[model samples]
Target: MGVEITSPNFKANAREALDDNSLQKALGLTVEKGFIKKRRLAADALPEFEALRDAARDIKNHTLDHLDLYIEAFEKKVVENGGHVHFAEDAAAARQIALDICRKAGARTVTKGKSMITEEVGLNDFLQENGIVPIETDLGEYIIQLRGEHPSHIIAPAIHVNKAQVEAEFRRVHTALPPDRDLREPESLLAEARGILRDRFLAADVGVTGANFCVAETGTTIIVTNEGNGDLTQTLPRVHVVFASIEKIVPTLEDASQILRVLARSATGQDMSVYTTFSTGPKRPEDPDGPEEFHVILLDNGRSALLGTPFQEMLRCIRCGACMNHCPVYQAIGGHAYGWVYPGPIGSVLTPAVIGIEQSMHLPSASTFCGRCEGVCPMRIPLPKLMRLWRDKAHDEKVVPTAQRFGLGLWVLLARRPKLYHLAMSVGMPLLAAFAGSRGRFRSLPFAGGWTRHRDLPAPQGRTFQQQWRARRFGR
Candidate 1:
């Protein structure tokens, strides 16, 4: 929610939002009601929901393991269909490639479908900075764009902005917009936005969209959305550019369908999204409509390195956003707390993978080790396990502060030998018990100063849990 998208002084911003009754009403309604509906719909639709999840996981893993072969085959198909394919190793290269294509096409106005890759590359701002106007065709994204805000949710970008907020944005941005024109209702707002953007769609020189799945067999870039915006974006303009991560390329349309089964049911509890558009290439002479020039930009952005590793399972994500729906932290703080385009469990893992874990070391630790995210994940992505691996990798890189490192080192020493562990606990317990005087909790922890500042910790009673378990089992 917008409550979580505070740019600076995030704590203060959140504090203010929590205190604001209007904002809290909107935020709480979004989380509680939306999640309940989705969960119920998912349960009622599929009796073998759990098994289907496992099947999707297996299919994704298999596709990822053979990514190179599939991507090569996909590129060949794209070339044969009169579409140009470009590979970008990182965001900078991707931005350059996309900007150059737009420049060659002389694109002044561009309409876009929802794309996390574009957000990752800051493509919208980049294009606007170069004097080209970019319009988000998706309704949610359009609202956020008009408000000069980033997406707060992947599936529902403007979820944070309620009807009242949207009415305000429309009144401010849409000049000469009549207060008497029924801006109060959501349907009225949608009508105004559609009417306003219809001309932009016809006049725009280029259409930009993200590929949900790229079929290697036919070079078709498949896009899925509830509305038909993706089709309009792919067809109404002279040139089309599809920005997709390399991991999105699958062996065939059949593989894409397997993913689709879980994708809709997980994200929005729908059996299928309203529109699933597939575009093979540019318009042929006989074809009445479609882009004249088609370009597919396959972005690696550190995804290739994740292959052959524990984190590779993450690539199996269909972006169904079920993990976000089930995440405790995400529900509390929302997507913007993670500070990237992708958010929730998937973002926490993928952001550090794309950027260095050193820069995003706090992300993995942001969770409470709650397994709900993994349990609800349609792909069964073992999010907590992968996050732990990232935690370990960040530690190996010395990303943690020196003081914390020293404390952990001491803990490791104490944990190695049973004699030292028991001896240290014996010495440490009395001191802790003494500090935990009246409250029965340590409010001012010495080593965990930052942690204790916000919350209290319980003092150890006597011995470790392992000791108690061993004593009960074998009378040790």
Candidate 2:
């Protein structure tokens, strides 16, 4: 239930992950395979994809600007539709509100859809500590839940886990099953998970899900999922609870449509997710099958504070996760190395904002500034720019490591004086180039072991860029 801050230890976590053979193998096979190709194909097929992305970004910007009005309108509509809306100021508040709802419903078991917000709030463990069992119905979530780990990826929670690992967990947990059952293939593993989760769905007293978009005009909480587990999770239980952050609200259903167009494509490379459910309220009297009670817990959790700041543009994120998908760093080390609920470039920028830069400074610095995340982002979020903002904040606050600070300080001192900078570069460049001789790359460097240990640092060819530029420009 407690929020564990491990962002400060990203270096150590990344190092351990790099050496983990199982994780590395899993990441290697999956990271570059599905999402990227599918997303590219999907976008290419859609002639208006770029226009839709622009519209989605503008819609989010406008809604965020008028967030207060939309929130009020949303609350009113939810009330009108026979549902309750609770505002939570922080993670603790959000967890308490959800727990109170479950308790009021006398919930002994809760079925959950794939919700990163629940993970953010540490809700599953909190509910369990309160004597309520929370079952993750999503296959990916189910796998990670059994292992007592958080989601490694946003869309694919168990992407870091291979079939062998899953088979082992299933055999270990589902002892009632035949020991000889074949679970080698993904299909068999999925079938086994489906059979096990079915009973939990029927037995659950409460259903919890996170909303992808909340429609203020219609009082609708929208969820897009490839699996139908979200539908079952929200409908089968007596009470349904929706978890969402403040930025999830859009002005109307039309705005939701604009965002939805890009959400699935940017995420899984599908034109549309299999299930897009909209729940306005609880089951009506004439309704056949749905939850009798509906409640939404809207958590601010420091998001409201970011409204007018330089980071406000981050609110435009639709959680499509294209940024992480295309990120070279994320692809190499995988999501767990980021050490937080969110991972990759989006995580790099947002984690520090929600959690504080002091605790998550390493996340921003983990990037190579490759700009792929920004290029692929559906909402056009300037991920690299935002990360730089975080880095600047870390430097201003003096939260960066002493060694890093000293290095930057030394560079700045030399940089301010052009003659000293040129002298150092002019002298340092050729010596380094000569030291390389035939190889032209350093296998190891004194202060840059971190870079050189894993891969060779390309040696300078000859003169520095400044030296070349002066010779070309003034004929020096």
> What does candidate 2's lDDT look like per residue over 254-366, in tens digits?
99988899999999998889999999999999999999999999999889999998899999988888998899888878888888899999999889888899899989998
Model 1 TM-score is 0.89
Name the runs in model 1 displaced over 4 angstroms.
1-27, 427-476
Best lDDT among the predictions, by candidate number: 2
lDDT of 1 by residue, 331-380 (tens): 66666656667778898899788766766677786788889888778889
The weakest ten consecutive residues by lDDT in model 2 span 25-34
Badly placed stretches (over 4 Å) of model 2 are: 428-441, 457-476
What lDDT score is found at residue 419 in candidate 1?
89
Clashes of each: 0, 0
The per-prediction CA RMSD against the true structure, in angstroms, equals 3.8, 2.1
